[model samples]
Target: MNPLSRIRNFSIIAHIDHGKSTLADCLIQTCGAISEREMTQQVMDTMDIEKERGITIKAQSVRLSYQYQNETYILNLIDTPGHVDFSYEVSRSLASCEGALLVVDASQGVEAQTIANVYIALENNLEILPVLNKIDLPAANPERVIEEIEQTIGLECNQPLCVSAKTRLGIRELLERIIMQVPPPKGDPNAPTKALIYDSWFDNYLGALALVRVKEGAIKKGQRILVMGSNKNHEVLGLLYPHPIKQQQTEEIACGEIGIVILGLKSVTDIAVGDTMTDFKNPTKEAISGFEPAKPFVFAGIYPIETDKFEDLRDALDKLKLNDSSLTYEPETSIALGFGFRIGFLGLLHMEVIKERLEREFDLSLIATAPTVVYRITQTDGSTINIQNPSELPPEQKIAKIEEPYVKATIIVPSEFLGNIITLLNHRRGIQEKMEYLHETRVLLEYLIPTNEIVMDFYDKLKSCTKGYASFDYEPYEYREGDLVKLDVRVAGEIVDALSIIVPKSKSYDRGKELVVAMKEIIPRQLFEVAIQASIGNKIIARETVKSMGKNVTAKCYGGDITRKRKLLEKQKEGKKRMKSIGKVNLPQEAFLAVLKID
Candidate 1:
């Protein structure tokens, strides 16, 4: 086992697009973990979706050996996702670290996501080391950004190491600060094994793989360990030091070290994130805390293009869920959309990335319904239910009141666009709580807004209103009581549950009308006239009709009497009416996506 003084565990955190992956590459190169020719751009981002999106979707852990002053030190660096959608991932990564390198963009300074994550690190009671990145850019302003970080985050402003991850400038100095400033991990190696399972996944051949930070005692190969949360005991098949691309086998992983444990279990649910691993014969008195399973904030229905591929999609999801615990799904059936799964996500981008992976990695074409937040419905019998899909909402006669999720949103934008941003938030039923000027040009605004109001296109609208210069961050604030009503869309007199949504009572009529209009545009005209209606209860708020593809049935009776032609046309109308009664609406994929973009 390595001595406590020679081991350091920390994570690198930042806002989205803050060059976290780039900085990680520089660190890996300096440590000589991988050769310069072998290293790729964003080497930690092994997933194709992450590389395409230019974002980190998962937290990666790597052990590096650095020699300084003739002393060898072990550095365990846990790289975390920076997007707001994966903030929970950041929290889990921080739980396993002793400190964090708070990377700030030298050109952009502190952003909405950066401030949110810093608070999380502070809550973990870890030391914060601020590092200014992107100093090689022509527009880089290190001094101004450091000042902004101090003023915005209230951190002591002084000389922070300035480095260019792209050019590898000032990297050696930064590495020196890491050893000099970041504290080594502290734990008792003599104690019983109480390792924190911050991350876990499934391997096709290895069964369940868990990544843990050993808090106390040691775990050796072939040792029996118990998962505290699941109460499942498995003999450790192997222990591994997690390298970025390749893993190294080890005999025993002692306390204060990060390692992976192989458990020969098939099910992913058998292993839980945040659960502790302890000796089977002698267990720890207490399990690790502060790691909660990520609760999904966005919900949508995903259906395969072909019903025969349902099993394939399920298998793919099972495999994906092995790696992603934030993703939650269950069997769901829709009258309009048929059988599907109702999946939950942390945010919009998270949902997008998951869908993309399913299609790209799993080779399946899937359709996702409009996203909705979980709503609490109080029934007349005094029972409450938390519902994700709008179609799951109770009937009006049974519902006493409806409550929707809300978030405390923080927005950073130019002062010139403050008025426009305020108006947009007000329309979404936001109540302003605080507003402050960070600089002469930039302002920070905080507001309490309904989660449903912003899950769809709030960010896009905010950016559009500010000319793409605004940044946004939000977390689940509370479930507030509101007069929420379900708006159901009916095509050809059949309610399409997949397109249903819970909207504010005041704006239900307008929203219902807008959806009807949008559906009318996306749904192609059929052989029979289709009636598109948006309704709440028995009240029809809006209506549109897709005229049938007309055919000249009367043309067959050319040169016949006008009355004879009229009689033929009347017969055709009767046939069309009968077809409309039995005809089903086969909505295209575009129709499902259009509903999500409604204002």
Candidate 2:
């Protein structure tokens, strides 16, 4: 094995569909980490959903051996997702590296996420090597992209390494540059053992496996280690180097190396990401600093389609949470939806991925309610509480004010779509913060938008209006006071907790009307009329009726006495009124999803 100075730890960062994963494939192949026959596109993306969508969901790490300047050098590469929802994964990957390959699509130039990821890499103090990918395309404009990267992001990149991941062009030079430019890891091998847990997952055979980057000393097989955060001691049963094809087992993971530590533990919660692992006998003095836990920005209710599958859903979530620490959930029961859970996610995409995984991996059918943002409610008594579910909202008279989460959004688009983009932002109640032209053809816009505005279909609307040419990214800014009201949806005069939402007071009427109208189209008609009403506190804002399935009792009276027929009709009307008063409305899965299309 090479010394610490010969090992280079780096990650590839870029915007969505910018070829980050493809570039990783090129690197892995060039270093011969796996045989040519075993090579496949996007080898880092092991999940079926990831492969189907062509996106990296979880951050993946692999160790490769390369011969650079007559010496075998170890390269630890972490491939990170580019979507804004997966930014947490990118940040975690960046923490375990010393450098990053800023992969920018040659034709797309600088985008919103490109700048956002650069700031993260800069914060980690990683040496950034700008690389222009997909340069073989006919639309590839390397010179223009280079200029945009310098002007928009202000990176010192007059001469960036241009490469085409598809054609394997300029790949060798990339590897050489990584070895020369990226500095070696710095830590003492003789000091007490210290390793940072960047990622972890549960395995049926080995239990929970933690992928860590050793900072000091060494972690050996059968070594007792203490988790600094949990303050628990566990023995390291094995060590292995990460590879795309298969992990290679080893006896010891030395200092300044990246490897997986097997603790043979069944519970994944026992090991947390960002926790420090050290020798139990000679432990490190301090835990790693600047470690912030992942915070979920969107909340929604996830209920099993079959009421009996609630336990299966819970178990699935527990296993999923082991793979993704950002996901959170708690037992929540709804009068309308029965037993379920309120799950928290980083964004809408995260929510969708989780829902799909539960159905596909755990084989549990689920119905996910419309996504909503958290609101801080201040009562008349001067006490404050944060609530994510609309059903948990206090009464209007009891609440003094409500504050919603806000985000600083960055959008990069062509100059021609500026008007459409601005109009869309204005419609969503956004406040313009800044505007600058990256070049004559590209414009950058920044806005302060309420998180609730973009929780549902805002991204879809933006993409549609801009003709799919816009790149967007956002970060949590602050909580601001807003005129917000909880809009409740009622079926048969009974409130449905899963169908409620916290909307702005100004648009409450329109939103409520649209919601009830949408619900009316999905709710199945019963023997009696089903009243679909949207209300604010005690006041009804909008109402729609799913008319009863008509069955005439008068039809049974064939050409008999007119008085007898009238009496039969009157009795039928009385029965209908009584049925409406005692009947229950069954809401389909689409009724809960209707809230997303209310806008």
Candidate 3:
């Protein structure tokens, strides 16, 4: 094959809603990869959640052929997730690309995430081709955005391409630019077998499917290969490209090419991101440039509403883990919710995506406990255990010392909300680290706070305080000793173990009071009076009481007014029958969520 005719691998990257997906669709359409009628908005956003949320959650790949100056070039485009939660995934996607099309929203200019994406791309040594998108929008200002990109990102965007993806304007030119700028993969086809695992997922029928980008040599079907990182050997069953209709089996997948390998491996974890694939007979000691596994900072318990479907939940989680390597789960027994899994996630979005996938794909109703961070606790015997659940804490006497995870949080918000944001952070036991100005209107505030303080509803609270104009980014700093207390929630005099949390004293009152009120509204009126209390050890910080109900009348009437009163009594009796007799009131799923949300 002609080296110039070979495929050029690249990926589109940008902040959320910055037209990365839109540009991908335009590129595919302009390159005639898909039919014009099939050109849907955000075509790469195949997941329902991704489409609904107007953001790409999963990375998708597509193949396009562009005729640049009569030379046909294979353009392999990888679309990556834009959210900060999937930074690790983004990094993996970037590894597969030799170049990156940095799509910047002409109107919005450069966002914090854009900067992050550009930095990652540069770190990967990817040739950056900055493209300004959404040029048709009313607020589009390509020139100003290009200037900002140059100033902030320190890139020379001398003539950044301005294109309206919606109008199909300058799209062809952009494709031509990609062909000219991005270099074809450079690898020795005659060298020892070497490939990079850019992404992998499990297939129900074929087992583990790895999206491998061959960097050197050739990978052939029926060849025994070793997953360099795991030292595991597997036989390749087949190969596939982006063409959905057909599975193409070639004699060999040469250098600079992207294809899927059906390695009859039973487990998805065998082929990790950035792992090198080599022929088992001749292996190399060098490891691929793969990223470390993303550490999950937030932990939560997931339970099914129907106890009998616990196995279904487990199966669902198994399937989810195949696709999302970041989600970690282990069996846990809850005093209130029975057997479930204590799952760890990178962040709140990761947690929600897993839960949503479980419910949507498996059709199971789930109840999740409030998220908690891992706490390092030292026992009197000097043994340390990481406690993710408050209920796992040992007795006060047994605990010699406890340290909670802390993060250095950087929040960029409008200047007007600086005072309010600071006050809220202080309430959460956040100590001021530094405060700087991003621009005249934006303030960059940094704080070192306990991870547990910001794990639950803290993001929501921060957004609420900043009026949705703030962006928060955090990295784990270290675990530090803190003045923390366990806040136990009680309903009908029985403690709800799932509702308990360990929080700093400064924010305990507000958190406890808010949660108690939320529980009171959602716990339903039982036959007996229910008291909702938030207590720290022996002290009660807040309390709310749900009054018990009176007996329902169901007797018949004979006369006119007596008949009406009797009818009303009968209705009351029916209503009481509908109410769940948990000592007396009816509780629904909504109530459960309400209690969890403290709304």
All candidates' lDDT scores?
0.88, 0.91, 0.80
Per-candidate RMSD, Å: 1.6, 1.3, 5.2
Q: Candidate 3 lDDT, tens digit per residue, 57-159?
A: 7777876777777777888888899887787878888888899999988877776678778888999899999998888999987877787777667899877
Q: Cα deviation of 89 in candidate 2 (Å)?
A: 2.2
The TM-scores, one per candidate, come to 0.97, 0.98, 0.88
Most TM-score-accurate candidate: 2
For model 3, give the RMSD to the true fold.
Answer: 5.2
In candidate 1, stretches whose alpha carbon ends up further than 4 angstroms from where it belongs are 556-560
Worst 10 residues of 3 by lDDT: 579-588
Off by over 4 Å in 2: none
Estimate, for each residue in 1-599, the C-alpha lDDT of model 1 and write its tens digit: 57988888999999889899999988999999999778889999888888988999878889999999999889999999988998887887899999899999898878898899999999998889899899888889887787788899988857788888988999889887888888988888888899998888877888888999998898999999999888989999999998877789999998899999998887768777788899999899999976567789999899998888889999999889988877899999887667889999899998889999999989998999888888998999999998887877877999998888889999998899999999999999999999999988899999999998988999889989999889899989988899988888888888888888888889988888888888899899898988999999778889999989989887667595699988888998899889878888788888777788778
Q: How far is candidate 1 from the true structure (C-alpha RMSD, Å)?
A: 1.6
lDDT of 2 at 21: 91
Cα-based lDDT at residue 62, candidate 2: 94
Worst 10 residues of 1 by lDDT: 552-561
